[model samples]
Target chain A: MTIKQRTFYILRTAIKYVSLLIITFISILPTVSTVITAFKTKEEYGSTNVMTLPKSWTYLSNFVTAWKDANMGLAFRNTFIILVFVLLGSIMFGAMLAYILSRFKFKGNELIRNLFLFATLIPGIATQVTVYQIMHSLGFINTMHGYITLMMGTDVISIYIFIQFFENISLSIDESAIIDGCTYYGVFFKILFPLLKPAIITCMILKGVSTYNEYYMSNLYLQNKSKFVTVSTSLYTFTGPYGNQYNYICAGVIITILPALIIFILSQKQIYSGLTQGAVKG
Target chain B: MGKINTTATKGTILHRLLKWLRSGKGQRTVIMISFMSIPLLLLIIFAYLPFLKMFEFSFYNMKYIGERKFIGFDNYRDVLTDKEVMNSLKLTLYYLLGSFVQLALALYYATMLSFKTKGGSFFKGTIFFPYLISGIAMGFMFRFFYTRGFVLDTVLSWLRFELENLPYWLRDKNVNNMALVATSVWKFMGQNMVLFIGAIMSVDRELYESASLDGANRWYQFRYIILPSIKTIVILNMILSITGSLSAFEPPYVITGGTRGTSTFFLLMHNMAHRHQKVGKASAMALILFGLILMVTIGQKLIFKYGFTDSNEDISQKTTRMLRKQRAKEGKQ
Candidate 1:
């Protein structure tokens, strides 16, 4: 390459690498700080000289307190229960809605599609009071069932994603099935549901992560302290009012996210497909 | 002949019934009308029913847990007259503007990533990593960054900025909301980038080539060829940004502990419900917040319709074809 061309190429390459390096550092900075701070003793954390290595590492005391004493254990249990029911219910309902919408032509097809699309814009918090009232009237207050139902049911985004994916399936499959005299219900339950596995997984992860991390609705609905509290809500009670415990707080944060991190690591391959496709299709 | 005719007619009716039950065309109608019964019922009862109830609750003098008295527009009057609420609203508008900046930045980064460059996959992956982390974790992360804590402090001191001299980000009322917005942007930029990148990638590259051949520069190609194509996604992102900004609870709730003295509209609603137990008034506030979001979204849709023309359809089709070819090449590697 000519000298001028080489100079231009070097400048472009340098900009790309330098910008990316800066971005990556900013993104990971928080996590790195949290990990390091978690190892310090109380005094070390609060000391004026915070950047230095802790005077001594206090091994796992924060983790223990955050896990057991701070009530994260109970929070973990509640989160698990919520995720299980919410994930299962949303996937089933969303798939059913998507299946029907993607395949069938009915009188109100356009109306139904518009309704679902419109429903997507209505912020969930907007209807919080009424939902609380409904839950209270039904005596579902402070119950796991109520928490799961509220978080998972009537999700428009998940249903939308499923519909987008379902639309891609060739109509010929349904055509042949109909020609073979299969009922619509039979074809949907037997053939179509199986074919929608990838989409199902996509909605599952999307719903699962959102539901798992959700705090506000759960905080309101699960009023009784002993009955149910997700990880985030539990943090309110974990630290006593006297002073905030940074170590335990860090531990709680880490503990709360560990499950999601594990799940993400295990199913890492499907994640990009699930997240990217869902975003694009959305 | 009569027997044959009768049999054929009977078979056709059965086939029609079967087709109604199974075909994708009829499936939406049947399924919508049939299975949608319970969900629709629940939505009406829970969603709309509560919103109506909220309207009712707002008019009364209601406490957290008590008999509500009928007071016509008194609560609305109070909410409107409260200087705190007004300040909170202004703060919300500021935060909303910050979110827009973040959204625009995300769009730019996403557009760059969508360009068929070498190492695009790695860049995209690094960018989207933050979205996987929860809001709560992100809140904690920011707390560490702002506070004098751990490794960041060392770097700051090395750069000759004394730790004690720098104002703590969360402690200052003026900068608290901005810092929260920065944290939010950090967490959300990745997700928005993914969405916009996907939208741009779905656009046809042929338009760019053609624009170039006509001696149009990169800026013109982006304006005429790229911007119009991603209108729907842009609109969607805007709606999400507005709603998400309005309903921001986690960051402020965690970092400031709602003592930032000025709250976002949703955070105010949350405090009313949780801290004060003003369920009735809180619900009213929530309903009002909902109305604001709805008005903005509808207004946005109207603006889009009036302001923008349909994207060039031929370019879109060509873009789809090019995207498929690109995907095929990736598959081989």
Candidate 2:
């Protein structure tokens, strides 16, 4: 309660808050500037610095130009198709694998699990050179379905999450279902699968975000950018000829970010918990 | 009649096999095999098979196509001795340093926000927003942000600094790597912070209250209580982040195209394979990078195990013992 001690405590608290504020500002600075720039016309962008607020927030020409020029329509469509197929295929495969490995006493059970554990240690990028050749020879180059198939192949995290979840669900559920004249397939699809909603959400958020943000493989394997343009790769349409066109580029960038931003804002709770749970299990 | 029936039944082996297929044991076998086969197959084809192929390709001089020369160990030697490859690896150290900086910041903020703080959730969300963004968009955003006379320069000018005084963030060799690493920290630090926060929140609250009842300060409490509790997760996160930095890509590849000496190992390997058509060399470089990452991961675990041998020490007793010593000294005085 001494004044000197009180002053020092106040100073320390002030520093902590101020430091957090400064970092929060820095974290959002780029996105905020881009948003500001996206609303500017090319002439306005040229006349004003990047930090300047636009005169009118409703300038729609840059967005229109970026949309058409960048072929975002095709990009969104391709990404949508990829997400749909990959999510469905991977979730099914992951849940099914987790069920069998955990529920049934089978031969080579431990061996299959070790195969995946060892696969995790292998750096994925290291093997991509060879993977590229495999895809090429299989005539999977530039094909949307091929990309989806490739995506479904990497389901390690989902399986890990599902397996962790399965440990908590009682085996009596499966036992009773089977005794009630249910096949293993029915026990899974009708009973256990529906109960896996939380785990599915975790996998969905983690896998979905990564898939949506995946640019390297999207750019590399899906080579025909025009036909196979993903939302992530579509932004690169501005890289070559219109590299300095910040107004349109920012517009394009905003367009790409809007969906993810909306989803994040709505599902912040699930995403946070899901991420923590996934991290612990993974 | 019985002999004829037996002979007929024994003769129909295919029918018996079909009958068994409909039985319970057959279904179990079928389901287990079918369920396990798909993921295991995918892992083999996409992961292990390619890993094996990459291993084989490292020994031969080849490209995406054309004739392959079995120049055993030559590619490996070149990868080891190449100055450019080694230099590209040295850039990883900058990222590693940046990542540790990131962890420290995350820990500080996690500690701050773990206690009662204003708008903690809002700050967490804002910081974590970048992680949700695609890497390509971040590259685009920072490209604009760091351009000369752009966002960064304009912001600096407000602080009474001249625009000319600032270096180009992505072009200047000295600061470019750091600049790229900053982008990564901005994008990823939030996630690490969240992880830390989650770990911190799970800690028993009464521990903090009990420590405060003693003459323990915040630093003592953190060092004795929070640090020991969250040690496993913190170390795990550190290992993961270090391994990730070894193959740092996206920022350099996207922003500067690995130009101006900003090329990290993966980006250089990418360029070598696709641009220069040196697949074998690139594969060798990849294997070498993997080995480096493996060594670093193992090295870190060893350090943690040997360096922190007091994993099972009782924090409360240690605090009380120190308190007892201080009281004894005060009594003597």
Candidate 3:
């Protein structure tokens, strides 16, 4: 190669790394500074600007205060309970619906498909007024089970995702199973459910993340914050007395994000692939 | 020419029903009914019922309780004519502009990292981290980050800019809405990039090698080979971002409390419903927004279907195929 080509390649590589570095820094800017502020003393936060380092890195009071005052234990517990039920219920219903839709030649199949198809078009926020009334009428306000049922009931996208997966799993398997005297239920649970793992994961990732981070609905329905303080709405606790205290607020924010961050880091590979699959299918 | 069952009783309704339940056809019928009922029931309770009720509620004057009088189009009139309600469209435009920048940035980074870039995974993880953070936390974090003489201004001061010259990020109407828009971009930009990367990865690598051999520069390869190949997912994402920008919330609601004129359309509807107790007007506003979104989404779908006919396979199918091939490769090893 000529010296000119080598020089050009070198310059391109440099530019690539530099641009990546800058973009990465910019993306992490808010969180990194929040982490810094979360450990600082109140005096330091006030006197120094946000970028400055604290004298000691082991300041644990803010975290403790945020955790107790925000009732994050209850928050995490509530979110965990919600995620468990939501994921299980949505996956089961979604899989069953997909199975029936994919294999069954039924009278109302087209209607059911279009029902879900039409449901996606209705902006959820637009319909909250009446949904609130429905919940109220059922005496479901300020209840955890009501929230779970609502979440499980509203999961249309997961059904579609599961249904898309069913198309890839060949029908010959089901036929063979039926010939082997397997009931339709056996064919689904014994033959098909195991194969739907990837789809389940995809749905879990999408559904789990949304349910975890769901703020507006949770805030509206879970009015008894002490009883149903989800991580998403838990930080609202700090917006009153400690609202101006940036250190405590930042600490509370960190407390909420830590779980998501950890889960994200550990499952980055699955998350990326799942998100891709979801995007394409969705 | 069918044989009759000797043990079956046609006269007794109960006996015939039990006989039917014992048959294979009966089991299939039972399974079908039971399976179909669950999701269908869920859809009715959560989606359809509430949707119909919302439509009805738009025409009534009511709060959470007491006297839901039918007001006949008055709420719709107010929703259309109210200055604060309509002013949300102007704020939405800022987010629309931000989304474009978000898309451009996402595309740029995806093109760069889609190939064999060093430490690509680390960079991708860092960029995608913010997306996992809850909206409420992110709002609080950014509130701290952008507060006067805070992270943003402090960083600027280190670059030799005077601290006094910096405008209040959350105040000062000229830049406040843009500040809120920037927060949305910060959160979603990585998600868009990852989608683009996945689409780009599914493209045949041989195309790039051949293009390079034909003396194609990076720009030429990107514009012709990469962009055209991943066009479908990109377009789909573009449509999603458009809907997203139209329904922008969370940032202004969380960070600035939609104060100093940063309220997006969704935020306005929320305030109308909750703060002002204008449930009827809010419902009308929500329906109007939904109608606008539906029109835009359907129009885009039409354009996509007819406009981009060259692509044969769906992107999901491609990604699934790629995964299967990877699994096959791994199995052999």
Listed per candidate, the RMSD to the true structure in angstroms reads: 7.4, 3.0, 6.2
Give candidate 3's whole-model lDDT: 0.85
DockQ of each: 0.46, 0.76, 0.79
lDDT by residue (tens digit), candidate 1, B1-333: 999999999999999988876665576457566656655565566666776777787777777466878877667677778787777777776667877887887777776666665676666666676777777666666666677434556667778988677666787787777877777777777778777776676776776665555555445556656777887677767776777767776678766776766477777877787678776677667767778878877787787688666665865665556545655776799
lDDT of 3 by residue, A1-282 (tens): 799999999999999999999989888888899999899998887787678888789998999999999999989999999999999999999999889998888788888888888788777876787788889989888999989888898577788888899999999999998889888899999989999999999899999999999998999899999788999899889888885898998888888888888889888989998888877754
Cα shift from native, residue A141, model 3 (Å): 1.1
Query: What's the fnat for candidate 2, on a 0 to 1 scale?
Result: 0.81
Candidate 2, DockQ to 2 decimals? Answer: 0.76
CAPRI class assigned to model 2: medium
Tell me the tens digit of each residue's lDDT in model 1 across A1-282: 699878976886677667766776777767666666677777766674545555556577878877776567687787877888888877877787777777766677678767666656556675676677788888888888877777766677777888887888898988799789776777788888899888888888878778777766777888776658677777666446514566667767777767776786678657766766776543
lDDT of 2 by residue, B1-333 (tens): 999998888878768877776787877877888887877778887998898888888888998879999999999899789888888889989998999999999998888888888898888888888999899898889988999999988888989889777888888998999999999999999999888888888876867776677656778778877887788788887888778888899789878899999988899888888899888898888888778777877787697778765442354455556656765786799
lDDT string for model 2 (A100-219, tens) is: 888887677787776776677788766788899888988999999889889998577788899889989999999999889888888989999999999999898888998999988988
Off by more than 4 A, model 2? A1-5, B1-15, B300-333
TM-score of 3: 0.93
Decide which is better by lDDT, 2 or 3. 2
